[model samples]
Target chain A: MRVSLKTVLTLTTLFFISACGADDAADSMWRKLPLNNTVLLTLPHGKVVIELAPQFSPKNTAQFSKLTQQGFYDGTKFYRVIDGFVAQAGPKDGSKKDLSVPILAMEADFKVAKDWAYTPVQQQGLFAQQTGFKDGFAIAYQQGKSPNSGKAWLTHCPGTIAMARNNAADSASSHFYIVIGQAPRYLDRIMTIYGRVVHGMQHVQAIQRTAVIEGEYAVDHRDFTEIVSMQLMSDVAKAEQIHIEVENTESKAFAERLVKRRNRDSAFFYNKPPPVLDVCQIPIRSRIVK
Target chain B: MRVSLKTVLTLTTLFFISACGADDAADSMWRKLPLNNTVLLTLPHGKVVIELAPQFSPKNTAQFSKLTQQGFYDGTKFYRVIDGFVAQAGPKDGSKKDLSVPILAMEADFKVAKDWAYTPVQQQGLFAQQTGFKDGFAIAYQQGKSPNSGKAWLTHCPGTIAMARNNAADSASSHFYIVIGQAPRYLDRIMTIYGRVVHGMQHVQAIQRTAVIEGEYAVDHRDFTEIVSMQLMSDVAKAEQIHIEVENTESKAFAERLVKRRNRDSAFFYNKPPPVLDVCQIPIRSRIVK
Candidate 1:
């Protein structure tokens, strides 16, 4: 989600103003809470909306908060666009010298055995607190490892938001990227992932692709889809009215749907795939009822 | 690789005239070969130089031949533009009326143990028979069950030409799609594999993406990247001089590169991945050496 710092500030102010109430306080708080917070990303062609998934990736949400509070991603553009691969974005500082705020590298959430064992068998509507989100921010959790080893991270699936790194490990600060094609799992732990473009991905994907720039071989020159403005829905009075829900992962209906796609037992398949599902391949769509 | 048909026709004519040796009596026979041996596809965004891969898929090639000869794809436009999936083109005849050509659905290419294996154990490259060039078309054997079992076909890797089919068994014709991202393996045998894009895939990818049209849910509008024209590079004077070479699949260098990528032993990889390589995940980079 391409957010402008102005919107973040507006939401902060609104949050404080609404908190000043009493009699209708609880109701007002719930009503003012962000619901189907949608961000409209304007591209050279058109716009696409991304609904954030906050339940899954709280850390990612927190990082997004920090970055926006500092106005870190305000003027940045998508700099890398590799066909069939990904489109990356980040701070304009190629040398890490221009960072406006303090930056840090995030840890990895590799799906190792112990990690997998600790990963609760996914349940419908039951939030899995590692690298998952309500919108498009990167996320992770503390599940298994040593006492301090239960850590999670944002994944590099399509539409993911990650920080760009230099040769050194802690080089990532204000840069980021969005996966536009096949999942680039190769970049799993090398960079810091913060969020993703949950709503305006089509707008991000439709940017005019160009040859790689000279100095930054990994970056592209296509003008990024413009950001009219991105704000937290909690800042707006109408935020309370919008509600959206994701299909419960552990539900029977969702299980059947996944089974059909993963195995293709339908007459259509002459050969069935192995009973394995790549977490990234699963689709998480959001919609509003009434 | 977007070819300007007009330019190619001019180049083909000039080359044909020049290639006719004055000393050979057979030159007279060759001179009679019509310049109409090529087909030009004009798109709005840019040009795509498609040398129909007929020899790779004789039946499908013949189908294309019949369609092009009849100017079936003349006014048609690219319809589908999935950001990371594919960009579909061909006759937008949603009725599936293009299936009039006589080629039945063939089994998937899993029969040939050595040639069709997806596991990394088997070697892979552009070495399928019934494989040859039709004019400038790069084609392979079109495999059928009965008399056509051993036949070859054009692999649908990227920049492929294919017949669009519905859920039915043998429905495909008119509508075709060019893969703009990773190869869509699921559609392999379900539709007839025909040819590939020889050049100008960027032009195809640059086409604007839009919501599927009203009646034809599969097709987008004609707001495609403009194609200056599409003609064979072979027909141009310096086309032969433009020397290029694909990495030999049997070479030790190719195997070593694959192994390195599969394991990610490079400094770039901080962790080790499972030693598995999906066939379609490989990268094939092309360059103009000379």
Candidate 2:
């Protein structure tokens, strides 16, 4: 069941060029723009393409680089899989035995605007600015108080990569999880979030619950299943290039799309819901846009 | 191993009593004054304590009662368990070749006021009403539009009991699901939602994924886990004696608590977030405050 990075790239490339057409093909050239900052998150089902937001947390991004280089996460398993909340993974090195090393903390991501509904831009498949990379970090911004003093932070949107922490102020380290549900900003400033999964999140979503040890409740045992190994997409073959086009965060099509979905203008819905969109509710679709 | 309903009710009583205390106990008593309309929800882990929201959806509630009387969902198993999205169940009979009846549609729950939030009315363990049940239907009153005119749909907070349907509206008949994570409003108007899980939701959450088919993802003919059976809490012992108290929807404590949590004055949070609480984001805590 293990999928190789090379195979994925090839399938992705074929999917994009053949399905997305030529104009998109020309725009897809942006992929060639040096992905040195890219990090390949290998999950059991597929790989997560992460564009590190270094600008948001310079130190954290550097740490991530060092950790990836050192292969710290190479063998970690995805330990927690909450249907829609998150899929937690990393050293599953039992916290009880590993509390000695203090967890690290990072600052919040940059903000874009407060109460900003959404403004579409030139991109085709991108969402909010939080949809893209900031150096190595992926984030979203919202105006809080003054129009100019809007703040930015890591959104708990699906596929978000975040550092795990204990119940302390500045506690979070390599242990991470991807948001699989509604954004849990309740954990916002309390935890240090670092990156986001740009592609292949479905693979993580479809992983079967393995090595489950029944406790008082069915909490995943750290020792149950281990992440066999991991590799980066950049190092994979050309045929395996995954042509992903995010919903342009700043595109007019995007905003209208949100409004459309919220109201469900499609024939599918008989009732119209009050128009509102939670940050996490926004979907960032990835198709083969080679 | 599947736990018994009696043990579950006993354990939950302990859980609630331990999780709450004193002056709060008395006030909760006030809020729980008259127990006219009640509903029972059974799960694998144990029996959940729930009261129907007769006010939100009278038609839906009536349909649910009619279906229950016919034992439509008695032997059904929970088919889907998305950690933070929902734990779905209902008529396992639908896909069975022996059965042909379709799912039924239910009306939406009422909306809550924007100004009101669920908080401790008398004690920390008890949360005030973010939404309340009227005539056995889940309803809320938020700030904005008319107190009654504002969109009032089922609050998809955790433990919400809803009916499942096909692509067409009004298709729901026997299938149902429970909210296990943050509310998924995307499914709001699209589906026939009925009631909220009054109790035993944890049991629903704890069910082990078994040999049932994963629909589109089933590898071969391999089966996924299926629910052995489902019973109403009223059918179990101790479930009758279960004293449940909901937070008063019209309480000032609910408003303040929402603001406090939204802002996070506690040291645990280093950054305070915007004070906007979505209708679904409000937490409504229930306890056996006898």
Candidate 3:
């Protein structure tokens, strides 16, 4: 689906119109993400909305959903924050043993069949055979032995939410982290990525980073950013809830956006280089609906 | 030159042995960057040392040097900080009109000739024909109409120091920014890259980010992170100076490091992915000398 710039602009205009009290118009263009699959994390500065990727990591997402429903993440502190890496948070004492929830078997949903319609950005990525987007998430696919047999996994781009585990693969319970800087592609297939930050990334970036001593983050409990409360969007009252609509990766507008980003011809550029695109560099637009 | 891992490890061991107080051995492998070309930017958290890239952008580097010598950056505030993007700073009030230094002619040192020996990482990049490291900076080179005729420019990777310009290509003056998140490769060839943060990037990342309103950062001067002082390292007393040594891009050790980063068989990685590397992911190791 090839969308022209004018058409995309029109679509964007329509999107805004829908956002500004025009529910019917907005509903036609933007698909509302399931409220049950969304999580609202409140910080002192603002609120961060996360959309779970259940199709990719069902087990991990289910466990996280169960934990959030039980108020397990409320009052948890972001204990470890390494600059240009990740911001890890959970219980203050780092004791997950006391949590009532059973440890989830590790779901390293590293790859999926390439059967789903995906927009390929590159034939090869920094650490993957192919890179593209799947349901608004940046992803990489392995080169299959056959044409349609490849597997795809979520790329560790900034704002990715993943389950934190111990040396054992099945150790992931309540601890989780958000990628806060350059995409740490090294962790792509090693950890289970269940969701991504859909809004309020600035709040996550505002969290005070900890000092590093001998390559380890030296965090103080008192200085940690407190999680005011975490609740599934569905669990919140309708009046107080915030709804999100992610730009469909399969849509024509997204294709246009991809092209515009790949080849920038702004007045600021003295020398326009050839168009090369990274999957993470392509932003998936997310809008809030009150 | 392709260097074997054993040889690199041996050199590293020797380098560590030399670092154990043997000033002579340390000086041999590491070239001492001219202190005159180095800037010490003091932040509330710590001092960030930036090494000028005079070879790539001579005019801009000279202007920056003069500005530092004249104490133009003293008491300046990092007024604009966007998470996973950039930390911009200069004279407050967003005015360079009062600065004593002459406004430099825009030297958009986006690309250089591929004459110097460069360790090429990829035949192609997201926006460039080729990607590699030149003099310890992540760079992309234009695909020349003919071999050896294309130009190269510094990439907008984390810690890269670039001149912030207005809409006009040549309007850069007293404003600059350091990339703090994922590499915004789209900015390549558009801005003037004069230097890079060699040490204390953690301090750079620690700068408090401002709130966002309608996609623009809402900065409050009262909450700004102050630039306590900015001075050339040479201007300081020899006894108080902090020296740095960047890993030679043309050296054998760097090549080995690149390979290791691309493919990891570490205990933590349950399933190691293919060895694909991004030039920005290959860190140019820089350290302080006693």
Candidate 4:
């Protein structure tokens, strides 16, 4: 509860650096995710994790790991959020469980390997001509010279998760969605995102929206938000897991935190900005381990 | 409760127009806002409006209409929201106002008028080298030719709003905030934006977020988000007015909504995109005229 611009209000007076209780103690500028393609979910207030990207949507991360190991996204009910845009969940109409899983195939973009541990970040991207970071998500590519050019997907940014298809680009299965605002860029290469919450994006920005403008009040069914289960962090139980890590956005201290987030040699800035860096306002960090 | 991706899921299955119960009846693509430079705010979950850019932060929208006409942002509380980023509110420390009102004057970049009504919308902008829309906010300019060669600011997209100074570029008096996610193009030209929440950006994305993380819970004070009063929609009361409108971003139906959002010739897109648009994902329609 501080702001007289003294204890950090916002719209800048420079307050960047609260990757919560920080002190990375260099685990080599962070790493971990991909324990059999992570995931945690759980919500009624917290526990989101996620990760996935199985090398860029392998059959939608193997049908979201066979629908969260068949607990099928537990109680599923973020029934279509859409505040800054998107929260969605499962079975909203996609109807429940099993049926030999099927329906997927549009990894939207993929096929990277011409040396793809990519880490660029933005060289003019409002619709990619370059934008970056790979493993921890947010991407864009196709800078050809023979990698069969133009591939690489995932870029909806804000905690992206993707999958919930319809106009038939192979209509995704177990319904999905997450983004939560700002980086829509018209669903770039059209959604197949696969995963990325890497630790509760504030429980996915505290989902619950389902749109309601004027004097509000219309989202009921006990106002949704459910999904109280979903595991697979290699099946959680090691005294109740939850380690997470992240930040090695191809480290060198994340290219010095992307050149201190693209130039702000800080003096609380006196009109400087123009080295440019809005890879969705870069904040890679992600922590939580004790 | 549909997601079987039939009734529009997100990440595109096209849910484009639902500017809520639409049907504008051609009031010529909307207009209004500027009733003594609008504002409304209120909050136990409804009413926001805002709209003040007195031609781009004129003395912080006249010190936010003289501290929202003296009630000084009623009950103040959104004490720092920061989920996708930013919600802030006044006096979390800026104290109970009126130190003879004065504390503005940065207006972070203005001086347009090389035939101003701008409108363009994007030519590669991740930190503007062209991005547009003028009277309905989201801007960026300067394309030099001697009118002092560089100015035109307002843009931190998402429901913007600004003002909350500290490191002294004319300290900005009563704290404010609002951009609520994604467009923190590093606080564009660094803060002084003034207003825009035109129509309760879903009650400012339902504020109440002050950082939490592990199984959440740390934003107590009855979990903040209070500000329940604020007026000056020319001092309300014409049977509770709220006719807003807005969508004349140099009309011709907003240049056919920026050419159908820069070529998304719907067939619900079958791998098309790359005609770029992201002027904060272009949606400019706003409404509520009854």
By DockQ, the best candidate is 3
Looking at candidate 1, what is the lDDT of residue B102?
Answer: 52
DockQ-derived CAPRI band for the predicted complex in model 1: incorrect
Query: TM-score for every candidate vs. truth?
Result: 0.63, 0.60, 0.78, 0.32
True contacts kept of 1: 0.07
Best by lDDT: 3
Taken in order, the candidates have interface RMSDs of 13.5, 14.5, 6.6, 19.9
Query: For residues A1-290, what per-residue lDDT tens digits would candidate 1 score against the true structure?
Result: 11234643443343333233223322311121244344333444554444443443334445555554444555556656665566655556644534554546444454333423111211110112233321223333445546544544555666776556666666655555666655665576566554555343556655545443222233234454443433444433563333434443323344345445544566655444223333454555444442
Per-residue lDDT, model 4, residue A34, is: 58
Q: Global CA lDDT of candidate 3, please?
A: 0.73
> Which sequence of candidate numbers ranks them by DockQ, best first?
3, 4, 2, 1
DockQ winner between 3 and 4, please give it: 3
Candidate 3 per-residue lDDT over residues A128-215, each given as its tens digit: 6667776778888775678767677888988999999876778788899998877888787778999999888877876767644332
Model 2: per-residue Cα lDDT over A132-189, one tens digit each: 2222233454445676776556655556777776657566667777775456655665
Score chain A of model 2 by TM-score against the reference chain A. 0.66
What is the DockQ (computed on Cα atoms) for candidate 1?
0.08
Best-matching candidate per TM-score: 3
Candidate 2: docking tier:
incorrect
- Give lDDT tens digits, candidate 4, residues B167-240: 76888787788887788766787788877787767667767777765443477877788998888888888888
Please, what are the lDDT tens digits per residue for candidate 4 over residues A125-227?
5466666776557787656566556567778888888887778788777788888777775777777888878776766776777766543456896778889
